[model samples]
Target: MAQITLDAPASHAPVRLGRLLTIILAGQFMAILDVSVVNVAAPTIRTDLHASGAGLQLVIAGYTIAYAVLLITGARLGDRLGHRAAFQAGLTVFTAASLACGLAGGTGMLIGFRFVQGVGAALMVPQVMSLIQRNFTGAARARALSVYGAVLAGGSVVGQVVGGLLVSADLFGTGWRPVFLVNVPIGVVLLVAGARTLPGDRGEQDRGLDLPGLVSLAAATLLFVVPLVLGHEEDWPLWGWLMLGGSVVVFALFVVAQRRASAPLIPGRVAGAPGMRAGLVTIFLCMGTFGGFLFSVALHLQGGLGYSPLRAGLFFIPGAGGFALASLNWRRAPARWHRPMIPAALVVAGLGYLGLEVFESGGVGFEVAMGLAGLGLGAAFSPLLAVALTHVAVADAADASGLLVMTNQLGQVVGVATFGTLFLSVAPPTGHALTVTCVALAVTAAVGACCATPLLRRRG
Candidate 1:
């Protein structure tokens, strides 16, 4: 806490924050990048492996499903194992999995390794927020989190470009292999740095794993997410709807179990913090919109307009730039802007989504609109993240971090499923489907902003 004070040595504080953030965010970016990077390499993988359509889909969905399932448990593991150890162990697993994926000989092997990669990501990524929470506060925390937000947006953009470049280059004639191989060295560097620099936060005093709470929540999440991830691909089969419906029942049981537990995984006090729940809701909506936009726009560009996957991905750069610009600088705005920032900025994002209808796809107008959406979306994330944690006690930061991230990942899953399904099922024409999906995305943003407005206004 003393490090956050104005009186702290400027040089020391920045040096500490810089070293920690670089190590933590590099790992974070690596995990996030893998989520998108593989999509670009999918075609190449299919050709090389002689994969079926479903096998190819698994190569992509497997990582996400595994990642979603284990996140909260991983965060709790950090508390038990210590943040640094969890991070190192997780990174090591992730890096090894990356290597395995690169060398995978069959479609099944690649899919299996990809899931293992997700397991690694789940283990490592949660520590990032806990580390930030443990080490920084006040304006320092804000700046650190802003960079976190920037990474969140930037990773997806870079993944597309990097994936495109690596696949196109066929570096060493390895084709899509470099995308996975690329993480090997970066992971090694981060692992070494993290072992030295990451906070060795003391483990919580003898708290049991809270197995009942952990198992219940993990089950609820898996039941919920599995349906969303695979359902649309299967054309929303009856089993998908059944699983989706059943997740609610399981989640309700989880809540009941948590109430009875002495040491709940997510504490009541933390979850009940002012603006905490509301902030999570806002985050869900905003991120869901982001995920939806990316899926629909990329699909439109590549499938509908006949652009190469590389070109489709390239167009996302302007949007990524917009996101980085707004996320990095929004704190400089007047204090009053802080409270209204989340929803208000989200409205700007919605306007950008709507702008797609007014402008041609991949044109200057489209790029500008995409950038505007990115900027607005970028500005919105960090503030809500702060608000969610703003009232949380320091002791619960790790738990809070996991819940926040789990919610965010789930939102993206829902967004992509909902938007992608809408795009496919509603409008038969590619152009019409994009316009309709954009309109829907714009509407979701507005609703999210409206819901977020009151909590932020009163809280700020």
Candidate 2:
């Protein structure tokens, strides 16, 4: 177990604590909210810009790609630069990027700005968890984590709703632009509040950036991700397959390089930790299903059911509300509950997927399917996170946290690329494709549940 450092006695007044926490939470919510917020707006963007399917995918994937690639580097930068400086810088960049996204005149510009926005988000997000870990201890830390978990779930739900509202409102006749523009006000407030309130942690400033490792990792990811993302669009050409093969080689090279590097980007020991390994694998599977489900469902509601974006957004509210309630209560639940809860949640989510499959033929049962999925997801989300981080040492906490989130993003990218390709390949978008995808998600959930069995048994 990593030794825990007691926080330096807080000098701030009691009233200031609330403001500090709020500022931190607002920053956290803003970064996370942007992840899902773009989904509902995709159709509007497509219409507004006359984008092809490939163009639309680029808009979403570009952000995720940038976000994933930069996250670890961002965290390390925080450790080097002082969390407060990194946080403020990230917030400023994120806000400016949001404005650029809003004013973007075409698909290419918007996608580029989204990539920049993601870099800002990557820079900002790690600080939230790091700050919480640094400032709080024991029960306080647990409580703070619970709150953060709720914020994560809540932000995702709110993103969908907010995107819907913006698209539906078409404020200032800006259509999809408001989805990006809405962040400006929120970002400004967060930046100002963070500047005033967030404490600086500048203790570890001597560590050097791992540029070599960063290059290798980025190259490896591009090799793999480019193929997965663009393969279908380009009809699985020879170069795509060649790139996929090269990704394996590049990944091997990356592993070797990291092992040899004087200052490794990702410490070999941290990545090799059994607990971290299991946790990341679980996150990958869980989020893979999650990313695909959200993308497909949004499309289904809009394309298949002909629901307005607002109506589609409304459908996700129950899930979000349920997630918030469950996350808030998560810490209070028994330790034994932790072992079974994640698997049970996966089972529940699987059942929801099954429900979706059964109800795909009709419009009337859509809400019921969504509700079941939400309840299951809400119950499982926090528990999975708690379980994943259960064995992490405090010193490695930041690294472990970065890995967990990176895995989640990677899962989403792969899920969207692979499953989306499957869905699109069926052509003419049919209920059958939805049914198959739902069943596949159910199967994925079952696999997650099976993996959790050992965890539950060991805990028992």
Candidate 3:
């Protein structure tokens, strides 16, 4: 038995990593882009569609709900249908749905189309990491993961900026339509390039779809997320609470189904891997804090401080800049620096967040704090992925990738909902709200840092 090196292709001689990453990341970038971009365009959408409050909320939340619900199943599909095929198919659906979203005549139409777009995204996203797992090993894989992590961090900020610009530009009097339409051309280009560049499956075929596990999982996710996304908007109706309770039961059943199924949606051994398990928890805390921090800051800046959408969006740039700088060299950093990076990132980010609480003015102080937080974000993301996948078998990579992504999404939803509740209930001043959120974020980062301590002791 010998170690598999990234230089040695597992399938057909390895596709060029550069080309592969470009095509795969293009699709993922679009998915991540849509997540934040819609928030910027929400007002325009409501006005144009004459949407009611409930309808407006759906317009924003539908895509996320659908995207979250289908992710695990989508990863299984990739394993079964083949990654290249699944990737292209998902993009095609996504592109078409994006076009439909742009042309949507009413709120209902927009919400429906967005849900379809999410399904497409779910099908496409898992393949990005799974393919990276198949195509590259060790250091090359580390670099590729670093690139992916950077895009994940930067793409959200890009969405903020681009969304603001597009809405404010009102390009061709299309208003919010461009936010959705923007994906159309990008999807077309990626599809064509991806077909040519992405690698095929590495001799593993789908071992049959686990329908029971999938249904239970989807039901659980739907139940869990619906309450989180809609509860606040709808004033926490009785049904919302019931759904939340039901989600736990459904999830328990899903676990039971997985234990019994011959071909489980998630392989138990992969989930059981010690490092992977810890990584998943750390990822949840990291992403939950990240999501809550972003939402809280955006609300505070816009609602409390009276900054316009464009200005608030611009405010996030320094952080994105810091993330770019750190992630660009993440893979090149020394091995000894790798494990220490997560806790260091957590400490840096926590301190920077504290600065956000203490700083009185918005000149150099704000930028420095943001930059530090951004740098930590990138550093933290890079190692988590690298370490989580360290022990995953190639056959289980897609499942692992899907689970990791799903946890991140769930964390985001939980973070937003929970912190948002506190934000609303406190009725604090702008500074106080920001401080509260940042304190929570700092605590979360610390927890994540503790979880990541295990990485320091892990050996090849």
Top-scoring candidate (lDDT): 1
Off by over 4 Å in 1: 1-13, 458-460
Taking the tens digit of each residue's C-alpha lDDT, what string does model 3 give over 1-460? 0112234355445446667777888788889888899999999998888999999888888999999999998888898888888888889999999999999999889999999999999999988888888778767788778778778777788888899999999988999999999899988888888878777654356487888988999999999999999998888999999999999999998888888899888998899875888788888888887777778778887888788888989888888887767776776677788878888888888887777777624667877888888888778887888888898898888899899989988888888888777676666687787888788888889988998888778755
The lDDT of each candidate is: 0.87, 0.75, 0.84
Give the per-residue lDDT of model 1 (tens digit) for 250-306: 999999988889989888998898988888889999999998888888888888888
Model 2, residue 109: distance off in Å is 2.7
The 10 consecutive residues of candidate 2 with the worst lDDT sum are 1-10
Q: For model 2, how does the per-residue alpha-carbon lDDT over 63-171 read when each residue is reduced to its tens digit? A: 7778887787787788778888988998999999999999999999998999999899888887777776666665556656666767876787788999888888889
Worst 10 residues of 1 by lDDT: 1-10
Q: Candidate 3 has what TM-score?
A: 0.95
> lDDT score, residue 157, model 3?
82
Local distance difference test, candidate 1: 0.87
Between candidates 2 and 3, the lDDT winner:
3
The most accurate candidate by TM-score is: 1
- At residue 457, candidate 2 shows an lDDT of 49
